[model samples]
Target: MKQQIKHQYAGQYSQLSTKDFNYIKDHLSWELLAAKKCAHYAQESQDPQLATLINQIGLMHQRHYNTLLQYVNPQSVQD
Candidate 1:
């Protein structure tokens, strides 16, 4: 009998495919770039308010990166 593929928002699966890994990799790359850019601009800004906003943006991106990273390696949660 042939198996079926089920799509879900959240669930545990026995395995992940190469395409899934590649998608995660691409998203991680984008998050990294966004974080770096926000940080760099935040440092370069002269206005205090703008700097604060940029810093917040950077933090958000960093959080996203961390979340994605955790998804990539669930074992790290124990560390």
Candidate 2:
């Protein structure tokens, strides 16, 4: 039997006023949630490939978030 894991987005990006920021935040949240759900299924099936794919998706979300943040605040790019 495989254990089930509940994944959640506990981070807050609502305070950001930029539209791009909000867009990225929402998509990132969705991606993370989906990845978490996939992870649960993968664990139940003991599929290493599925687990790796989920991890890659999570990383992509993180990358997208970072790229959006850079677009929102170019000034921060230098810091």
Candidate of highest lDDT? 1
Off by over 4 Å in 2: 1-45, 75-79
**Candidate 1 accuracy as lDDT:** 0.79
RMSD to truth, every model:
4.8, 14.2
lDDT of 1 by residue, 1-79 (tens): 3343333323665445677767887998999999999999999999989999999999999888888877777555443
Clashes of 2: 0
lDDT score of residue 52 within candidate 1: 99
Cα displacement (Å) at residue 28, model 2? 5.9
C-alpha lDDT (0 to 100) for residue 59 of candidate 1: 93
Provide the lowest-lDDT 10-residue window in model 1: 1-10
User: Per-residue error at 77 for model 1, in Å?
Assistant: 6.3
| Error of model 2, residue 66, in angstroms | 0.4
Cα distance off (Å), candidate 2, residue 27: 5.0
- The C-alpha TM-scores of every prediction are 0.75, 0.42
**What overall lDDT, based on C-alpha atoms, would model 2 receive against the true structure?**
0.56
